[model samples]
Target: MNKKVLERHEVPVADTWDLESIFSNDEQWEQVAQQFKERVSEIDEFRGRLDESSNILFRALSKQLELEEQLGKLFTYAHMRHDQDTGNSYYAALQDQAYGLMSILEQKTAFVTPELLAMDPKVLDALVNEKDELQAFAHMFDQLKKQRDHVLSEKEEELLARAKEALLASSQAFGALNNADLEFPTIKGEDGKEVQITHGRFVSLLQSKNREVRKAAFEAVYATYESYKNTFAATLSGQVKGDIFQAQSRKYNSAREAALSETHIPLSVYDQLVETVDEHLPLLHRYVRLRKKCLEVDELHMYDLYTPIVKDVDFSVTYEEAKQKVIEAVGPLGEEYVNRLKKGFDDRWVDVQENKGKRSGAYSSGAYGTKPFILMNWQDDVDNLFTLAHEFGHSLHSDYTRSSQPYVYGDYTIFVAEVASTLNEALLHHHFIETLDDKEKKLYILNYFLEGFRGTVFRQTMFAEFEQLIHAKVEAGGSLTADELTREYYDLNVKYYGEDMVIDKEIGYEWARIPHFYYNFYVFQYATGYSAAAALSKQILEEGQPAVDRFLSFLKTGSSEYPIDMLKKAGVDMTTAEPIKQAMQLFEQTLDQMEELLEN
Candidate 1:
């Protein structure tokens, strides 16, 4: 029976996150709201005075930063409240108001760019060199110059901004449909009771030991989606076209280039990961064959892929237990790092569970003034224990950045964010394996690392490659008919999974269900980050304090440096194949170990 009543959910303590720390009461937030309105209106006070001199520019910029910090606090607190319980209309309404206010604020701030652009570049450069505070804005200002061509004429920029709501309709529509409207087929639990299906529950269902339960859940949920796939595909195609239109209008070579260039990520990073993963496809094939042999099944279908090959071993670490376990796992990270981590968890730095209508999945979030908090839907199981460690890794990273760096460099890019989180998982796996003498426990850990590679590295790369192909097709004026999309996705699956497994037709429709496809070229980072992290984790384990210091330094960086350079400092050079090669070697080693254990 579900512990949650209509008003709230009973997520495990570790699964619960703390948002109350942001604002203890609605009255406190309300006071900030009044102050925010007053401060926001003051933004125009220095507008006409901005061009007077370098001091004038700094003054106006200072005002903008003040407003930003206030607004960031306003919105983060409200959004976190809403995420805790979407059914709570008080917080939900507060969130919407904050968001609408933020949208206006964003448009208001757009003038900052045009205003800065209006300044003489030489004068601005001199100011940056002269003033420490002004130096912080230099990266943002230079980034604006890189986007000058895309900025449009003042009148045209306003026109485009005015059309933003209409232009974003397709992506917004996808969100509403997927999150609010689209129906999912219900699944039967082991108790023979029906349960509402969800994205979070979908993976849980696949891990069910009962084959009938797994098959019913898999087919039922997707079948509901299959019926409305054409609609989903239409919305998705519109989003793709929107991306291509934006990229082309900006005079970029492709959507991929436009997106990656913003982060200044090397195009070779994308290409090299695809190339390396493809080169190593046979090893994946071998893993699949081993899965078949161990399961004693002559054929493996896509649905059959998720079930574990080794015997189940329970590792139900409680919230308190997980806290200690993760600290022990990263003890090599040094005393100072571990102590800060302890402080973060002890303080209300996490919001850990799913309440009614709460958002799906997990993330670490905060503003400059607040604690970096994590949100989760933690179950009382081994996987949830790992998720606890993973998110804490992110929280600790954010904490370090906020504490050590100025607000200007407080937030890191998504590219490096995943690296920090996944590294914790790798460390926790190592820690668990070293402590457990039981072979079953060892195999369980091995299975997790194996699945991690398959899901993060192998599968995300496939999605990245597919995303590139379809976008190119769209750019070439070719329409992506549902049949063609399926065939292409299916063919790619066959090539990746190899001849060792049966390629289910339903697996082709999997593309229609994946939400990440809408994220343009974002999926590749998951694969790259995971591989880089595996190598970095190995370095931290083997090299001790120097590597640990370098890794922690990477977290402290935030946006102070570009992602590639920051990661390079952390000892994983992602531009080449060595990190990926090392990661694959570890995967192979784990696979060999698992196979030997099963044989014995």
Candidate 2:
């Protein structure tokens, strides 16, 4: 019999995250919201007085940052509460209220940037040097100055700002449709019992030892997606068009360029990732062949890629055991790091189980001044253990950055965000290998690592390529209909996995189901981040103390520097191909070991 998912309120109190840290009650949040609204009107007083003096500029900037910090707390608390149980109407209204306030705030403060741009460059520079407060925002001012060319006239900027909510409608619709409305048919489990498939459950089902179960789950998912293919295509097309509109409005040559420029990442960094990954496609193909050989299948299909080749090796890890193991895995990073991690574990920083109406998957999320909280639907398996460690990496990163930097620099960019998370996974994998004495378990670990690399580096690079292709197509006066998207996606799969494996026809609709494709060039960072983490983890394990120090420093630095510069300080230089090359080499080495173990 299939187990029933519990209601959010039915979950143990200890398993839920403590949102009370942000606000004791929604009544308190409402009071803060009213105060924030009144505070927002103060910006009107400094409207055109930015160039009068450094003190005036500093005051205006400080007020903006202050309001932002308060709003962050309010918004984070509301959204998280809503995510805990999407069916709760009260929190849903709270989230809507929070988003409405954000929109109002954006319109209210839209002129600040244009006014700052209007000031003379020399005058702005002198102001920064003259005022201590201004000096504090020197980096912010520098980044603003770089956008001088892109800053539109105040009227145009205001118009664009007002259209922000409308422009995001497509993405919002996709999320609602995907998460709330979409449903899959009940598929048979490994034990031949009917199991309802969910976004979270799909992953575990794909890894099942029973081929029949995996095939059923895969087909059920794609079949459901196929039914709504036209709707998804329309939503996806709207998203792509939105990206193009923003890029064109900002005077950027392409959507990819516009997205990368937000973090000051060079176009070459993206190009280099694709180039390097393309150069090493053979290693991925070799791994696919190895999978085919080990699984001993006549033909390896798309669904077979996920299940382990080695059978009957129980790698289940309870959440309690996972906590201690993760702390021990990260021990090389020093006592302070491990202690902070333990504090998070003990203080209820994680919401650690799936319930009915809970958001799918896991993430680390919180605002400045609140505990860096993580949400997980944890399973008793190695994957979930790594997921716990990964999210902790993000939380600890958040913890350190919030403590070290001001609210302005408290958050890191998406380009570098995955480094800490993936690094933790890599460290935990190393720990598992070293500590486990059984060869079969060791082989499973090795297989797990290779599979992760394939998914993150190889599969995501393919995704990055597809995103670029689709965006370029739309930009060149082409349509991104279901057929075009499906064909392109299928071709890429064949290219990446090679002719050795059979690319199922239903797999062509894969693009229709990817939530990331709507994310506008955001998928590439996964590949880049995985490569960087692979290199950094090797350094931490081999180079010891110095590498640990650098890795921790990287986490603490946050948005203080450009992601590229921050990563360079930690060790990897993303502009070069060395990191991706090294990661591929590691993948190859792991494959060789797995092959040897299987043979023995």
* lDDT (10s digit) by residue, model 2, range 1-600: 125677887899999998998999889999999988888888888888998888898888888888888889999999898788776779878987888778777887888999989988998889888887677677888888888888887777877877877777787677767766787889878777788998778878888989889889889999988888889899999999999998899899999999998999999989999999999999989999999988889999999988887789987789999998999999888899999999999899999988877777898999999999999987777788888999999999999999989888999999998999899899898998889899988988999999989989999999999999999999999998888888899999999999889999889988887888888899999999999999999999999999998988888887888899999999999999899999988998898888888888
Clashing residue pairs in candidate 1, if any?
15-352, 16-351, 16-352, 17-350, 17-351, 17-352, 18-350, 18-351
Model 1, span 1-600: residue lDDT tens:
243323355555454555666777888998888777766767776655666666777888877777888788888989877767655669867876786666666556656666667778786788777667687787778677877766655455545455555556666566556654665767678678887676556676777667788788788876876787788788778878878887886678899988788787878989988998899998899999988887777778787777666655555556678778888887878898889888877786766545556666777888988888888665556666778788888888888888888776778887787898889899999997889898877887788778878988999999999999999999998998777888899999999999989997778888877778888788998888898889898899889889988998898888988788888889878778887778778889988888888888
- Tell me how far the alpha carbon of residue 408 in candidate 1 is from the true structure, in angstroms, after superposition: 1.4
Q: Which clashing pairs does model 2 show? A: none
Whole-model Cα lDDT of every candidate shown, in order? 0.78, 0.88
The TM-score of predicted model 2 comes to: 0.98
Flag regions of model 2 displaced more than 4 Å: none
Model 1 — TM-score against the truth?
A: 0.91
Question: Which candidate gets the maximum lDDT versus the true structure?
Answer: 2
* lDDT of model number 2: 0.88
